[model samples]
Target: MSEPREQRAARFKAALMKSGARSDTSLYEHLVRLLSRVREEQPQDPVDVLEEMSRELKRGALQQDRGALRDVPATTPGQWLAEQQRALFSHARDEDEDDLVETPLPNLAEVAFFFQQAGVGLGGEEMQKVSLALRQLSDARPLRSCRFWGKVLGTEANYLVAECREAEPPGGAGGEGPGEGGDEDAAKMIVPPSTYKAPPVVPAEERGTGTNSSAYFVCREPGLPWTRLPDVVPAHITAARRIRKLFTGRLDAPVTSYPPFPGAEAEYLRAQIARISSGTQVSPLGFYHLQEEDEEEDEDEEQGTTRGRVEENPDFEPLPVTAMSKSLSAWVHHVPHILTQGRCVWVNPAEKPAAEPDEDEEEEEEPDEPEREEGPALFTPLSEDAEMDRLPPWSSRLSSALVPRFAVAYVRSNLWPGAHAYARGRKFQNVYIGWGVKSDAAFSPALPPDPQREFPGGPEVTEEADPTPQEERALRAAAEDKDETEDETEEDEDTE
Candidate 1:
């Protein structure tokens, strides 16, 4: 089976020459270095040494190629969507600056300035893009009112939210184009479908400050056309509370989990925005004095002229900025507390019986349970100074805690982390730039390994130590005894 040494040497020389098509100088040098290293160390297995060298070369090659690992340019609005955004802010043909019609879009520039003052806002670059993108959005759609809601950080990309009130409802005619359609049409399909189904009926929401008052639009970057989110229902809110998920920044991404979310990422974002706004939206003490709206309108109705309908507070005043921040009581929840059923309207603030029914009249009782729904009234005192924890749900302090005059009253909401507001004299600004998650009392997130306490554990085998040989023998003996008993029973049956 032995071949001549000259013949083997000739085969090796031929293989080396053809390694890179034609004579390869790099391969020859690499082989020479490898052979020299192996010859000096005297490796027991040259084959294993060759494999190790190949792996090392691969790793080194990957590390050396800096071009492959270069950073991607961040998404920006400067280059894209420029024309439409400018057209909305200015008339194309007109030269005069006076004709520059103002847009109802919130002055995010000023908002950004306020954020800078409070030390909680986006950077200059992101703010500029966000501002530009917002203009484009306002131009693209018909909005009753539009404002920068907040930025929600996702895993792959962050979402810029635009809180808007539609001048017309989504189901109305002429809702086409990007950002035009408020519901189903706004979604971007990552994957195409052969079949489709109609969107679910969205519950009609009444105006006034509440959870569902405004619709939310999201985009990965400012220049991108906004995708309008679906109106979140109570069920979505209830289920969202049961789990925590990091967004993947795609419109049609499915939320595959327990207590099953009814729709895609859009619906999940809608639910989260609703939940976040309900809890964190706040104002300085006495910033809003709610008066009973349309108090005398329903005179002809069954419930006759009521005592000014105990709804919006008629009169409220403040002492001063320094005095307000001295204690936490000065601050109040400007937004209404969301009921467990997800209604944000301040109905039944406390459990007091409505007017006593007549002797002939029976009590209008709910069939489900006896007690009426109850919650704290709107603008209820936040919490007292004493009994306050190291980290209270809300903490109030002046820009200069003791000094007055130039001090701005800053109140930070620890419950939602990034929610903050500062009141200087009458001027106040509220900004929330966060992951759009509600901070719980617990530190870690609700995840698998240690599942949430609310949900029951799934079926799983309990881990146990391995049995000894003697224990195994005993188990086998028990099995044999059972088999013998069964055989004896069968034999007795045969005899019978």
Candidate 2:
């Protein structure tokens, strides 16, 4: 038989006490109100209301371990590793007692920015380079650019070893030209310098008087930089737009500038542009001198240069003049598909929805239903909603939970690492966050803070509220009255 509401409440109160909730009357009254509401609305079954309350409290406690649900919970061993890897390689630090430094892995937009910076160019070239590089790198190493491995790869290592490769010669030979009917013929090609020989310079006066410099293309250093979008392009536009967009027209506005981008976004965009611009008749003078550090362990090692073995020769592929030219043709003809392939990864401008396919065609290519990797463990196909649900209600309640309009300076400070971890987990699921450290040890406690005076910004003080002057005065007067009354009572008792 079910107990009376009062009896059930009494049991819940005991459970709460056992679980470490404060036993103050105010808190008790608050819990009682909730219990009354739950009883009035939801009927109890095999599990009594008190039992339900206990279960909920337990869930709440577990949620705290789940980083208050702000953290992306590990779904699989691989994902857990990825989280660990990110945390290990993150640029953020923990300043609070909680010690959870949220460090998200670099994202595609950021990846694109790197590509753009590499002068691989954005659009078609970027797509091709990113995909080809990743595929090649994966073949070389199981998960070269996986989020966990991203930091290890570094900008130079990723570019040299994991980022996309240029079209190569047939026979997998570095300098040898392609043979007829070779893969090199189909391989995507970039512009060659010979195509754009500078015309014999005419007299300075003969130059057109109406100097109309096209903002579309600017001269750059040879290599990817020449052909690809500038790292400064996105920055320029972003800065320009930000300056215009966030303009309150107030001269004394706080933080008068759009925050500087870490150049990741620009790199990703450049890569994207390169990918989209692939196969186009690019000018070789359009060089993007991709700066790569010598990642070679010995003199024989060239960062991106692969070592051949019996199964896979360490030789480089060569491209033919004709094959390189054909890349331009393919780029022009397949422009639409190439442009839209994976531009969704861009951040400066968020991706627009893909146009609806024709009814008959839609039947031919049904949108692939999301498939969760089947396993004994709980593995859910990720979604914005699911990710949001993983966080505490307050954290996820903001319009832009990922990027809020304004955050507490403390939350913002704490969020840097958390954001890093969050973005990494969401974007790159395969990489470990702290790959070097054991998963359990990734978030281990750090050195204790030194003793210091209590202040507005102390870590110990979470939420601070100021009391009214009247309230402060009342407390002071009450203390004084109590002391005086105690003295008078003591004197009367002594006389008796």
lDDT of each: 0.66, 0.29
Scanning candidate 2 in windows of ten residues, the lowest lDDT window is 206-215
lDDT of 1 at 15: 72
TM value for model 2: 0.14
Number of clashes found in candidate 1: 0
Score candidate 1 by lDDT. 0.66
- lDDT tens per residue, model 2, 228-266: 222222222222222212212121223233343223332
Top lDDT prediction, candidate number = 1
Best by TM-score: 1
Q: By TM-score, how accurate is candidate 1?
A: 0.56
Q: lDDT tens digits, residues 197-236, model 1?
A: 4422323234323556677888887666788786666556
Q: Model 1 Cα RMSD, Å?
A: 19.3
Estimated TM-score for each candidate: 0.56, 0.14
